[model samples]
Target chain A: MVVYGVALLAACYLIGVIAGDALGALIGVQANVGGVGIAMLLLLLVSNSTSIKLQLGEATASGITFWSAMYIPIVIAMAAKQNVVAAVSSGWMAVVAGTLAVLVSFALIPVLSRLGRGAPKV
Target chain B: MALDTLFDSLVELLARNGLITAFLFVGLVLALSNWLSKVVTRGQVHGSAVAIAAGLVLAYFGGVATGGSKGLADVGLFAGVGLLGGAMFRDFAIVATAYGADLGALRQAGWVGALSVVIGVVLSFVVGAAVAVAFGFTDPIAVTTIGAGAATYIVGPVTGTALGASSDVVALSVAAGLTKSILVMIGTPLVAKRIGLDNAHSALIYGGLMGTTSGVAAGLAATDPKLVPYGAMTATFYTGVGCLLGPSVLYFLVAAIL
Candidate 1:
């Protein structure tokens, strides 16, 4: 059952990758466009569908949940692969760009918060 | 002589199946990180944050030891780490996070949350690109890549790879994104009350604007456990938004400017 979930994810991933490439070609970008995002949308659609949900059963659903929580480890693997020292040594641009972006974004949080103040409560 | 042969065979076997070895090694790192988070930091910082820091350190040493570009994966025993941390699995893992989201809940966040996502991406891009210019990066590709990195780490590399930026530039974008993530993780709770990040509505907006799921999630967990899901929801969408916009519209915009 767990394997079924993995199979489903693999299917979504493949489709997402294909669609992303197609989109990139269509736009003349020469690269996959939002493959991860497309795959996520596909997964959300398949899992939330009532008919597919019935077929998935509890075991398969738990498998998906298990992998979803695997984000932490996957992220760790990603971090480990990055060359932080080289990036830092390349120039000051990386550090400056990152810090400035975050600081500006953080400062704007209050302004954005105010924009939503008048919305109706759900 | 017999014991030496046994050890060599064991090493060869692990080298042959690097993925399994990588999984085991990462598990150890995470186990240690979680412990450190609990004991040393007293849970003030999330375990994943600590784990990432450790990972970066290990990667630095791995490169120094092997003189290779792929970091620890360049070592024979951990070769599977290359595939495990490669684009395929990274995208797969990111997509899987959408499993827990409820579509209905997203709709409840309203137009404000959606607005925040767009504004967040644009604002971060502009700021990052400006800083890149100030630092003398004249190339549009480099500017766009770093700008996208400010949107999120995922967006940075995706844009870089798509645009054919050099490895060093891509690495810089990653560093930029990582810095943003760590900052958001540490700063969220400290400024949560001051920024009025108390309710699910505000959390949704915050997530959209911040655009780093891990940072927003961990920060909200420290602020209020119930708000993590709400913040993470929009933060997930923020990545999607950034990925779509980064290499296309954002790239073109930077090209026009510089």
Candidate 2:
């Protein structure tokens, strides 16, 4: 049944990739565009908005869940490994951005912690 | 002669083409990192962090050894890494993520929860873009891609791929996200007491503040297992919000600024 879901994903990607190309051309970016993201959104809308009764099996349900959870990590790890080699030479800009982002976010912890009500404001 | 050379021939084939070899290499790296985490840091540092660091070191050597465009790809045996790490698989993984999420919790998070996701995405993106500018990356694409990355690992690549940003920029985005994730995982427990991270409401806020889903989940697990569900609930929104704003509002904002 995971295949059932993948069938849906494939359709979304096909639409998404084409839309990405068209959007890229319009914007003049000439890239992969938001095909990946678009597909995700399309899938999200379909899954969330409608309650399709697939009556999936336990194994299939697990399979789909596994893919959903592990998707980003597996793909990013693979992509990052190949790209890290090139990124090193792209200069330290990427490194700098990453380090600075972490630092800034860390700094905001105290302020952000104050946002929600916590333990009677004590 | 045939019998003697059989093993040599097999090894040669494996080394010559990297498709399967790349999978092996990834697996081996993961195993090594898990081992390091267990024995060295005693799990204080996650295996994921260890693997990323090790991969970077290997990539540097691969670049030095080969002087090629792709680090490990320079080695004939590791060529499979290229195909394994390509966009096709990345997109596939991304598209599949939507299936598992339950959006019912968003309503439960109410207004504060929603606000947190939005603020988290914007703050992270702004910080990433600022650093990109400081580093002289004037191009909007690079800035937006990196900014998206700062939002979350998933958002970074999706944004990078969408904007036609270079692979290096995408890689940087991933690095930024990974660092944030590792920090969140380690820091959450230490700061739990001070921040009053003791309830579902606090966990939700924490998740929104730290948008990395895996990081939030792991950190909450360490701090308080009961908080995991709450934190994860909002962290999902962080990814959703990041993905939504990354290529649209954030990209345009970066473009206008630079």
Candidate 3:
């Protein structure tokens, strides 16, 4: 069963490559759309657990990472498609956004936690 | 007659360049995402980081080799695809187990998995948006960036889920680690040019959006909703600070290297 699943995943990867090539041509960017498809296939594989009742905590974390990652390009492409933004420029914007993210995360994470501690129970 | 002709030509251009081709790509990618999640995870362990890592790394290399440029969007897309594929593996196993007439445990695992992601995205989006406004940022890009970061802080489990599928977990984590660096290296500049947000305000707005999404993801993964609101707030605030400080720091680092 496991082998079959892996084989199925590989097949999907091949299809993804084909799709990515097509998408890449459409976007005219030096990027591969197929990789995204393949990666999604891999995510679905890891998140599943059988009767073993795999730890909920672990699985959820894994899911979040994959889902967010998946959306990045889609968002970029969507933004590009809408003409809200272009694909090439997104890189720099992401840097500014990322830097802001790190600093803000560091500063506010603790303060927020403390405030929550003092706040009335909901 | 010329004006009418020009208008018709423009409409055709828009239809050809923007709509049909782009959506076809989106559909292909989305369908691929769904299927990838299902196929790769047919029968794999749920919580093993190593297993997840193996799958992600393979995907990453595959992506890089195929595409030639491992830029911001590529990494983000890859990480998302990796995580989904990994998670789907776990989900399917449980469903398969239930197939043999065992439905008891499926409820908690499946529901929890779905709930965590759904709530994380929806709630984080709301909180991030509100905070972005509170911070006096009106740009949509900034808003989305903040929301995405905020989603990171909701729970550790969710964070793990995010990382589990990505080949470079640190790179994808909260958009602050290696992942953000790559993105900033590529995504930040591109977006800045496209939107004409070349000033400090652009920096702040962009930072806020990115930070919010990262924070929300972590908060949700940690399994603490109380942190969600706080995560959004901190993300917004710190993003502002980063906006103010990033340029100077970046310059100094660059200068020293040069």
Task: Give one digit per residue, the lDDT tens place, for model 2 in A12-82.
Answer: 77887788677656665434344554665566567665455355556555554655554433432443344
> Lowest lDDT 10-mer window, candidate 1 chain B?
B217-226
DockQ of each: 0.47, 0.28, 0.04
Enumerate clash totals for all models, in the order shown: 0, 1, 118
Off-target runs (Cα >4 Å) in candidate 3 are A1-115, B1-16, B42-178, B181-237, B245-258
In model 2, the runs with Cα more than 4 Å from the true position are A16-35, A45-51, A69-98, A106-122, B1-12, B15-17, B106-258
State the lDDT of candidate 3 residue by residue for B1-258, as single tens digits. Answer: 999999888656644454344344445654554455457655231112112222234434544445533321243323333222332332222122111221222222232222222332334334533454455645443443443443332221133332232322222223322333233323332343343333222222332334433322222212222222222221323322222222233223323533
Q: Which candidate order results from sorting by lDDT in descending order? A: 1, 2, 3
| Interface RMSD after interface superposition, each candidate | 3.8, 6.7, 15.7
Q: Considering TM-score, where higher is better, how would the candidates rank from best to worst?
A: 1, 2, 3
lDDT of each: 0.76, 0.65, 0.33
Report how far residue A91 has shifted in candidate 1, in Å: 2.6
- Model 1 TM-score relative to the real fold: 0.76
In the range A28-98, model 3's lDDT, one tens digit per residue, is 43334323323333334444554222533444444343433333223323222111112123343333433
In DockQ terms, which candidate is top?
1
Candidate 1 segments exceeding 4 Å error = A113-117, A120-122, B1-8, B136-258
Candidate 2 docking quality: incorrect, acceptable, medium or high:
acceptable
**Per-residue error (Å), model 2, residue B205:** 9.8
